[model samples]
Target: MAKNLLPMDALIAGYLHEAVQDAGITYRKLAAVTGMSINRIGIILRQESPPATLGEIGMIGSAVGLTASELVERAENVARTRQDYDLVANDSINEFPEGNDADYDHA
Candidate 1:
């Protein structure tokens, strides 16, 4: 399932790493708090296979002082941002700049 997803592997993994960095916890400490192996934690931050379960995700949120819902929102937001970017990129219409539309143009 992940293979078919947007932003691809390292994207999500990289975001996870960024989240940990932003969370301000050492990997070992996070692993200890999440009750998972340092290796498993690495997999999550690294975005490897055997992806984390929802429970693990929740644990990560707790470890980072984020709620599970907030964490999911963070992840979901990545997809949303990508979609927004794509939409803007594909748009062919030019948005008139402020004064450019000052003339009564919309008859």
Candidate 2:
């Protein structure tokens, strides 16, 4: 079975969607500006896929006139206001994989 997405994923997507709207950027315009595909942008904005990668977040943020750090900070602020923020934040940490040296091996 496909794993369910973390609440953080939806939260981030919602934040991005609002930011894009506030910036007056359509998905097509954002795609053109960021050199990303509309389908990918739609997937990210609509929460149809997993949370975006750091690189993708940066691209999207740039298109919306925000830095990646700023975008993430804003998202965290939004998360903090939710009643289940603690549960969602802790769950995200618990779900992350712990890695050792071998996990980063290139050879």
Candidate 3:
């Protein structure tokens, strides 16, 4: 059986939302700058749908003052953190018993 994975589209949308908020810009302004329709921007930012292409991501990132690479890198970091948490949560249960002095590396 395959393990369930979080959707990358949602992660990217979440990062984009945070970036837009941090930039202190409105959707109308972003639409105007990126030459994108407000509804399309809404779809992407709200995670109603993923952007159709890398060019769309680029346009959105540029409008929000982030490079495409930077935007993706940050989203990737978020994904990694979530994956790590899921793994630890799933695997660590009952691994440590009461009064057990097992040496473990905390790196």
Q: Write candidate 2's Cα lDDT for 38-104 as tens digits.
A: 9989988888755677788889988887777887787778778987565353545554356665766
Residue ranges of candidate 1 with Cα displaced over 4 Å: 1-14, 84-107
lDDT tens string, model 1, 1-107? Answer: 54322243344455567778997899899988888889988877777776666687678767877665676666667767675443232333356666778674877
**Model 2 segments more than 4 A misplaced:** 1-4, 86-107
Best by TM-score: 2
Q: Rank the candidates by lDDT, best first.
A: 2, 3, 1
Please write out the lDDT profile of model 3 over residues 30-104, one tens digit for every residue: 999999999988888877744435677789888888877887787778768875433222545547665564555
lDDT of 1: 0.67
Clashes of each: 0, 0, 0
TM-score of each: 0.60, 0.71, 0.65
Q: Name the weakest run of 10 consecutive residues (lDDT summed) in model 1.
A: 84-93
True lDDT of residue 75, candidate 1: 61
